[model samples]
Target chain A: MLSKKQARAFFLGGTLVTFLIFIGLTIYSFSKGNDQSNHENITESVVRGKKIWESNNCMGCHTLLGEGAYYAPELTKVIDRLNMKYNGQGEEVIKSILMSPVPWQPNGRKMVAYEMTEQEAEDVVEFFRWIGEIDLNGFDRIVSPLAKEDNNN
Target chain B: MKYKSQKVAYWFFALSMLLLVLQLVYGFVMGFARIGFDNLHEFVPFNTARAVHTNLLVVWLLSGFMGAAYYIIPEEAQRELVNVKLAYVQLISLAVVGVVAVVGFHFNYWEGRKFLEIPRPLDFLVVINVLLFLGLILVTLFKGKRRTTTALVLSMGLLFAALLYLPGMLPFDSQVMDSFFRWWVVHLWVEGVWELIMGGILSFLLIKLTGVDREVIEKWLYVIVGLTFLSGVLGTGHHYYYIGVNKIWLIVGGIFSALEPLAFLAMALFAVNMYRKGEKKHPNKLALYWTLGAAIVSFVGAGLLGFAHTLPQTNLYTHGTLVTAMHAHLAFWGAYGMIVLAIISYSLPNMTGRKLYLTPRGRAAFWLSNIGMIGMTVAFGVAGVAQVYLERKFGMDFMLVQKEISIHFVVLIICASVFTTGIIMYIIEFYKHGRPTDEAMEVSIQ
Candidate 1:
């Protein structure tokens, strides 16, 4: 039993809301455009590693900074962890791990070979290094690899 | 013995309700565990329970929709369903596949995606079920007395659902390609095909209940189906933006998904207009709630939030967060779940030949469930924004952040518990008030 005036108001209100949403989205999209174009300062090695990552579909197995497949480890913080674990031999240790066939098993985790050339492995290590350097201060927290393993058990 | 389509629909409805109850229990158990993680061992872990919860929701909704279609199509077409045996067979196959898929999750035989977790074997069974369903629907429509607008759109939806699911099941070398096809099945079905079916069913029911003009309802259905497909097919781009797909997905998914709200808005307007112009009064108030609420919720939850994250840029921030979960919970429940409830409310009395009114307790239950849902939506939405702020703005340890966010889990659990109590009350009232004679009247009318 809505009056004509009320119906008109309703329609007008709906139109206003829709227009506001469109405006908000336009502004947001424009802002993100700036962010994407700001990546011109990225290193060549990182760019090469990104290509390799995409070509091999590494995201199908590994996650980078909480994004991608959860089948493998988080590579974003791998550089710092490798540095800490291998006593400052961050890049070399990562390269060796990728090149050398190491069988590491922790229940429910299947061993998969890292099939990459030495130079490709180095490039991936450099990618991780670059990601580690990106200021993640205002980024979503990556899923904890250890916690996921703990859950599986 | 002649097979009655009403009998089949009732049986399927009952079975769907049973599954729904079980799903709710699992949801509650999972919610509780989220609060007290130490209580449940890995034997029935959160991930497994979550897989069961989501998959069950999909299966039960499909079952209910299929049952409704089978019941309504024949009556609207003014003929018997072409193959009653095939309908029964489709039901059995779906039930078997659903059970195996759900059981497989508890046994750790899942593929590990949130909603698409059923293992390969169970997936094959589902594909078979879909094919059989499409075949039955198409054959029935072809052999029926006349083609109504509802029958045509519903049949088209069934056909598209089967076709879309096929590509997703195929093995593809590229994960990006696989992901694209997966969204084609999941997004297209819920947002696209299902909307068509729901619109058809809703229009049919409204025509019967309110004595609205068939022409008006049918026109609304046509517009809804058109909008659903036009916006929804391109809306698949929303998911593609972040998954390493081409950058074009950002523009396509964002702009089109933004337009998706217009469909829901139109649906709302249709309902409101019908109510305004109707010659006959709606017999049940609750049914009116279901009809109008579905339109509002789908508009706000699915349409608005859909726009919110449609932008590849915003999605970069919102993907995988609780914000996504909020959108999903509201949209699916509002659009599909409420529509099904509305359909059942309208048809049940006709099927049973009983004037069913919600008891005071039932009314209370309805309010409780509605309020609980609203609380959960707001709580989860706020929690998601908070998580985004804390995680992105502050370099908090990811695990620590999750633990901190456990507070929201507690709130959601409380809300779900209230909702569960409401559902239980509803079940009790349904048993007390539901009349089989009302259905006898409906059959006589046919």
Candidate 2:
């Protein structure tokens, strides 16, 4: 029979230990050597593109790194996936869609047309490229078939 | 009902109901959009609707929890709220901030970070609002004669929840880091401290409704919340695994997250055992239904369904797909949503001096909502599993796979309609209870 005091101790002690360990794990994961996030590769364009992505709430519809509403396509490897599909015109296609005045409706599912400038579109493309390069513990292959197909080839 | 100040909770509950209705509306907007009737695309895009839906859920649940705190604290502490007027001010400010952020979303005036979409400026307002809420709650609890474990646990949960929100506000140039910290707030709040709030409320309800010994119930409450943080703190790894983080998360998240269900399972068993062991069953059948339903359904939804997709193997396929949505819906509904409603159900009759728990409509609301939500879950699961197959497994085009799964949305809409009817009935019952009267404190004692 666990006493009330014992139960309280268990709760407090367990929480403290786990929280400390969680913090330690977080530090370990984010350490330079363990970093899979491509920290050094992040350029000014990638940062600006991320800003546009957030300001526009691209994640509301499209998923990045497999996190989002699942309403639109996953854009983690959009550059690679698109380049493979569009004969290396993937960046142009993306920019065109971003710069298009009208909504981009693929199979009647409408994406809010951002109607961005060429510069802004290029920034977004840079963001996508940066995102595509990061190692995602093999999830990029799961999301972009091109990655998997390339591997198979 | 024991104190006049407890009536402040009624207004907060009203706010919660209002926001919950708005959440459902946004949910329908997204659902209808899925089936290609995106007529509101120009004014309210899918992203806007999604941000609204999720943010509304967070607001409503927070409001509900605040209301529960307002009601429960005074009783547990043996005193009226220190300043009822200030509490009302807190409520109004909270509502204003929620409304402003919601309206801002329509105009692209949001930060667009999924759940934390409120713009940076509005995030400050939220912090102020929550700080005021916590101040009122903490001041009232400490000012009172007694500080029970239930009160301390509930307040601690509230305090930690506010602290966790700060992480989401941190600026990150890396999308990966942004998501990593975002889960620190979202995942930790939902899976970690929120369970403490749930446990606290469940402990309070069990003591009152079951006539269970307070010490016994409080002891188990500690154990339940203990299990929660033990597994849940480390379980944040699940979100980290594929989000450009190190591979350590894959192993850590897989093992710890698998242990997460034990907490929920323990909650279910505790609630059921408490009920069986209860010698004096209070007459609030409606509250009991919600309380027990919350426990059982959470085990199945949060525990079992969550387990279904939580593994690294399965999550590798189902991460961003409808499968996550499938688990998310039932989990939030069963765990957070139902507990809020349970607290409301239990507190309402006492506050209004209305013994309307015997009404058939209340029972209808319970069954219809549960059944409809279950149908919706099944619909999502089938579509999600199908999506994993056609899209992720078979490498079909995203749009093409979506077309194959669009039929599920139709089923979802039907179930949603059923679910809406139940909620409407529940709200109507809520409305029928009328306002909380100070005199009911005396009336309910009889």
Using DockQ, give the best candidate's number. 2
**In terms of lDDT, which candidate is strongest?**
2
Clashing pairs in 2: none
Alpha carbon lDDT at A149, candidate 2: 82
Question: Which stretches in model 1 have alpha-carbon errors above 4 Å?
Answer: A1-153, B1-3, B433-446
Q: Across residues A106-128, which tens digit of lDDT does each residue of candidate 1 receive?
A: 23232234456888887777666
Q: Tell how far residue B369 is off in model 1, in angstroms.
A: 1.9
**lDDT per model vs. reference:** 0.66, 0.93
DockQ scores of the candidates:
0.06, 0.92
Task: Kindly provide the TM-score of model 1 when superposed on the true structure, using C-alpha atoms.
Answer: 0.77
* Model 1 local distance difference test score: 0.66
